[model samples]
Target: MEQIWDNNDWLESANHWVTKQLKLQKINSIGRLKPVSGWGLGHVLKQPTEQGDVYFKATAKLPLFSNEALLSRYLHSINMPTPEVLAIEETHQYQLTKDFGGGLAEDSSATLWADAFEQFAQLQLDSLSYLKDFNKQGCLNRPISDVAAQLQLLIEHPQLQSLLDSEIILATEKAIAKLSHNIDELSQLEIGETLVHGDLHIENVAMSDDQCIFFDWSDACISHPFIDGTYLYRMPDSQDKTQIIDAYLKPWKQHYQPQQVEQAWQLCEHVCYAHQAISYASMMLHLSPEARVELNTAFQNALSASLRSNRQTVKSTTCVRSKFCGMVSGILHTLSLIQIKAGEAL
Candidate 1:
């Protein structure tokens, strides 16, 4: 059978696949297969069962899904709170995993955030030994050189030039040049790296009893441990930010000097922002023209904000540039494909 694309098609396939994989006689009371957010290359189905709920994720991008499965198994073996992988259909490019209930509450208390951060710190500390394994699994290795290259590509992209005003573009280029020096400074730091949950927002976390379980490992990478904190700092309210950082840093205090940890944290935040902007730009190619324009504007705005911040930080000694610029080259290359498609349509 051909791979499914739409949710309706996946639902039809899942009825048979789930029955065969789980050995269920019939799918009794299957809940609505709603689309999950935050994934561009795949779709997730929340399949309910008498026993419990299981999630079925189908992706055309096999490597990302396969990596998630591999990382989940590794984390499970290490006693981290990752969902169980139930089945893998290599041919269809789908996988089933045991779901961990609803996500963390929107108005979650400070206590819950504290517990989550503590667990997050412990996960980073525990996974240090498996850095080599993570790299072998095709997780991104974001070195300073790679990051500088990505920024350079973005600065030169034709689409980027057309998107921003000439003056703004010139300012951005100057900021990137200055930021390059700061990136070099970061390359000299003696920081240890581990598996970074590239996207670590509260929506990706679930609270089970007293334990905080994390899901959605598609963006996992091998980078500085503090890379995960990039999203954490952005998710909390301004008043709660200090507490969240303190909780996350409490466990690492024994392993790293306060200044070293703080430096890593700052660098990782900018890296994460740049990475996110690049990802959004890349995703624009897959969207409809109307959707593409909307997202393009958003990406442009975000890029402007990042450039402005970079300009300010470029004057400071603590400025650290991220290697997300490497991804920007690929995104820029896709502009030709988009142009070709547009010509064909005309």
Candidate 2:
């Protein structure tokens, strides 16, 4: 197999690879192999075999490939709700696994979210003993220094200058500095480390009958388990956020005091916001000029909205400045971050 440089090449190579795999498996007919969107460094195609429907994922991102393969196997061994790895083409960084079909709908019920969170919490709790294994797989332990460094990169990025003025930039920096200080304090607190699905949004989860299967373990890491709750905070306002959080923490209560659980939850919420800001900033570095413009415009609009929301409570000049700084931080953290779509020209 040749190196896949872009989405077209990836699709072509993946089709050939899946076809060969189908033949080897003695599946005579193959269904339409459609590409799954929203992935940044991989090509995933849904494959229909005589046996059943499965998924083929191929990535040139070696770290992600290795992490997913190792972590999925570990999760499967523990009977977690993840797809079963059927085959691995290590030489080419491709893997075949059972497909769980389209994930929960965009408007999936609150009950579904609760169920997923419960299962995810259990997975996190059960995997604590295997932290050493996760470390061996090169999963990142997100220390305060690393998080701070990422924030610094985002602050220094050339692209940010185009979107924010000097005043806004300064305010944003102050807000980030405060966030960094908070993270430093949180880092000092003793917390359990476990397998965190670094990108556990609703889209990453799929439902098959009664089973909830999670895929896209590319961002899996050995970090504070609360990091996984970032997606829960991004859920639609219509859903009961309190109920979802309660369901997620219910399992942890078995081993932790209520106060400890709440503290971890609060720390994780802040970490999630900071992590998102850093991620978007990092992504900005790789994006094309056109994509950056789109993102910049979107970010500015969000920032403006946040500023309006802050004006009501901010009376004194000092309070206004503080609110402005927080507003900038919140805007960057909550921006509807985008990636170059799988098939779109980059």
Candidate 3:
């Protein structure tokens, strides 16, 4: 069988990206770029120069770069639980980042772990206090068109045909467009906006010895606090997820409405998997069968759960009922901080 990975190109691309994006010369073989399992675009490179541990992630085609950058800047400015954004360059097809990594996600004490999440949750809540306005700073992206393109690509590609459903597929396109229009309507209601870590899944976060610092600012943005909470809902472990939320919401549930928080979780339930589905399909197109089957199954389950949960999100304000009934199972929660690299879209 033909191997899908190009051993030579991975390292070559990393070096080129570092040179162009960081403008740092003298980056030696250091090590090779290893693609992070499950994620299609994130490439982790081991650097020999910086103690055989420091790594670089070159992410291209991330969806929410500007928003992520803005949010990371906001968090960093306020002293939040995010990674230091080393460098970023927003060209056409991708954005490159040099992340300051120290330890793995599983290596942290309970007190320290809680503190990290608490710090991050506090940062998000603080930002939400008087948050309002979007950065007319650069080109405004069209979410509908962008998501539609992804769906279209999958439909057109033979390799990813398994996941497509004609009726559901078409409905998803219209739903994405509707969501875009709803986003426009958000400002009309004078909804307060806070810095959001557009995509805050657990894998994107890493814990160092002294802190629980998070990386991946591609999804950073100024949006409803609910959106930020929803972003936090992606952690796979149920107990861990609650702990993260409780720590974040501890100091300030009074400042937020519970219903709104529920809304946020439901929204994330739908959109996060929406992202995963697209991501999974893209990976299936290029990955070996083993990788494809695992990701595809996960995507399928997520899509089903999201669809079931989002069904009740249509103006039912009592409690944010989601298909993933656990998030809103009457557990008040809180969160810590996130990071933003230059121009790397989430």
C-alpha local distance difference test of each model: 0.65, 0.64, 0.50
> What TM-score, over all chains together, does every model reach?
0.76, 0.74, 0.55
Q: Stretches of candidate 1 above 4 Å error?
A: 1-10, 24-39, 60-66, 90-93, 136-138, 159-168, 232-237, 286-294, 311-346
Q: Tell me the tens digit of each residue's lDDT in model 1 across 117-165.
A: 8888888888887777775544667554455567667657786567667
- State model 3's lDDT: 0.50
Residues 220-293 of candidate 2 have per-residue lDDT tens digits of: 77777887886675555554777888889999887786655765565555556556555445444555554455
Candidate 1 vs 3: which has more TM-score: 1
lDDT tens string, model 3, 133-249?
A: 345422123232244356555656765555656665556655665444333433333335455554554455666565667766654555454454543454565676677677766
Instruction: Candidate 2: list runs displaced more than 4 Å.
Output: 1-9, 29-32, 36-41, 59-70, 163-168, 235-239, 287-346
How many clashes in each structure? 4, 0, 19
